[model samples]
Target: MIELSEVMLEMKDIIKDFPGVRALDHVNLKAYKGEVLALVGENGAGKSTLMKVLSGVHPASTHEGEIYIKGERKKFANTKEAESAGVAIIHQELNLIPGMSVAENIFLDRQYTNGPSINWGKLYNETEKVLARLNIYDIEPTDLIKDLTVGKQQMIEIAKALSLNAEILVLDEPTSALTDSEVDELFRVINELKEQGVCMVFISHKMEEIEQIADRVAVLRDGKSIGDITKIEDITLDGIITRMVGDEVDEMFPKEKFERGEKTLEVRDLEVDHPLREGEKKVKGVSFEAYKGEILGIAGLMGSGRTELVSGIFGAYPDDTHGEVYIRGDKVEINSPEEAVEHGIGLIPEDRKEIGLLLTRNVVDNVSAASLSKFSTMGVMNEQEERKNTREYVDQLSIKTPSIDANVATLSGGNQQKVVIGKWLTTDPDILILDEPTRGIDVGAKVEIHRLMNKLVEQGVTVIMISSELPEVLGMSDRVLVMCEGEAVATLDRAEATKEKVMEYASGNF
Candidate 1:
């Protein structure tokens, strides 16, 4: 029988330092069998650094640390060695190969082979059994991962970890990409894993999810452990936030209203057909208007076409869209993002890593990507102007980086998001569309972005935001547009909108 009280994994006096920065300083953490340990921290607070050290991404010699598994001290030279010792990390950015089948990704490196060739039938059968064990019936073993939704892709990631026979699972912000129902399903699977004596480490920014799923909570701040591990019931959300940030944040959502101006953008009879499905429309006659000096919010559940509607207007899906988009009452033809930008429209996409920033490029390149025309003379980019423009926006947006030339991949999630925003701001668009702008960022950054939105409105720029976070929608927008299925079902003024009411409209309750 598995001993639930026994510590499955332990880290002692771990110290990891990067160039010019000590990322983790004497951090200690432990995970017991059958318990979910929640790790909480601000961006760059060393939570991920500590986990990377344990997973051998930093190796033992690179960091000062002692790792014990099952009461035996062990040293891992690489990620493969750590995995062989039963440690698996499911990262925030999924590590699945999109073109491969779900079954292939699950048994990736270790295939069921016959004479050094894969046995397809046995692979499919084993994959089906793993899916059955997880009570996931919707996904087929042979379906390509690219065809699956983000939620299903995450499940495939979990299944891959299980295939490794991982005794210690490190889930880094697993539900950041999931819908409400998907989140519930993931929680159920985590519970099942706990019952099977799997020691799990969960890192998340959502306080409610931490309270719901974590058995114990540990807080990290400024590369140091702020306090010892404590039971979930003993710590409040305020307590956790205080320890994570080392400051009192009185309100999570701060709203500042401003006077409205003339209409800056107007969309009429906007319709978009499904790209893959013929004669099927994803957005149906969606009409809305945004004025200068006001933030308009779009609220909807998953698969409600909120993103499609915005993308279509931004000319991201011109091949399958039909819409009358007007900027400052002048009808515009925006068949591509270039045309949209020429018409003074900017979009901060929902998936920042995928669509917003060039991950391998430096911060200067990303911030100046959209507005290269401003720095070009006679069809050649002026390096001086480009660097000057990038520096200006970096300062304006408060982007944290060692220098403007740092690779975007090295920055934390929040800082990456700020760079994306700065990229759009450099375009000098009169209108901006932000989809899930604050999805994975920390609370401090969220507030900063909210304040920036207000500042933009004050500067006479119209803002349209789509978010699943209800508090953000209510607190930031002057008006809320509720979408369901493929249409705009309700538009409520800020004074009239409530969480329950918007949810009812979003869920088709009314």
Candidate 2:
């Protein structure tokens, strides 16, 4: 437990501004020697900006603030200076190189060298010691990062921070990509860190996790601190939520019943080979059907091949994927994304930045990208029609952006997701596939997306969604397909699909 009297880190009167808006306004926060201080806020509520200020991503000079470490006021010029001051931030995005060795990634840039050569013996020894200190012996220093699961990779990140002698650790949505067992393992590591007197600042949108892990909670709203930080014991989940949004959240999963129509899409003996590994299969012989006017949820742990199954149906890997797909009871050949789109199938890929959105382009460009043929004529472009369609979808989806010309990367995670969905909708797909639709967004945006799914199903669009979040799957899907090790193990209706049963199938126990 952390002592309330000893303050390890403090930020007072912090104010940050971007061109025409204030990103953070007079936000104050403190952390003790050993405690998890959760920073809770809605999307665009300045939580990320505040952490950036602390980590010197926005240098001390850039933001108006007074930072005190162990009662000494210090101004950081850059991220390096913050690290030297014992502050380390693990971003929401993983930063390790996939092909590199774990030890090399941990001691990145700072390695032991003799004359003109790196001492491989000392390097491996140091890495082993660090990993041992974290009570992790399963991973070796020579192991490549790609071989480790997402949860183990997260541990390596924490071990790297500890190697820097980081006294203040800032974790930004660390559990966003972790499984249930992995989250449990991470909490174990956190508890160990607490005993060692490491102060942690946790940022998450999941209220249940906040309740489980935080010693205290601070709420941010519209660029300002809502009130004094409250002890976890003193604050209710509803109370913290009200402070974050400044309103009561009546329902999070706003799902509605819709009449099921004919089978829109059906697959038989679907298989997808691993893109890089020659003989390995990412998705095995999986067979399922999506009915019009209904939402079909795909549930599995990470690496269970749920995403690959949908991607195969969408023709992501043509050379290695083979499946018999039927559209409205007629056999169809979709060997590529273009052919799939021609057959009235649309897919919102898992990674929005890498697979879905063109970050450098404007909203109109991204929204109209998949359906360019509809707006263009004989190789000539039609800008007016594209912009008109973009505006209509932006309004329909309630995408929070300044203008249709704004860059898609500038939008929030939820809005970026909406833009991707809107882009797919423009293709007029008979069957829509959404993978991890609400992975990193806040609760309000999650609810909005759920409502949008309800609306889509109501309009007779067959929706196939893949989610790691079990509550969302059970709440939104009429039928759930559970995958394990690249195979569809079981299919359950809404009434029959509980969290335990889903996990059972996902773990390959049933």
> Each candidate: what lDDT?
0.90, 0.91
Global CA lDDT computed for model 2? 0.91
C-alpha lDDT (0 to 100) for residue 285 of candidate 1: 92
| TM per candidate | 0.93, 0.95
Error of 1 at 211 (Å): 2.3
Give the candidate number with the greatest lDDT: 2
Root-mean-square deviation per candidate? 2.6, 1.9
Q: Judged by lDDT against the true structure, how good is candidate 1?
A: 0.90
| Candidate 2 error regions (>4 Å) | 1-3, 97-100, 114-117, 276-280
What does candidate 1 score on TM? 0.93
Give candidate 1's error at residue 27 in angstroms.
Answer: 0.7
The best candidate in terms of TM-score: 2
The total of clashing pairs for model 1 equals 0
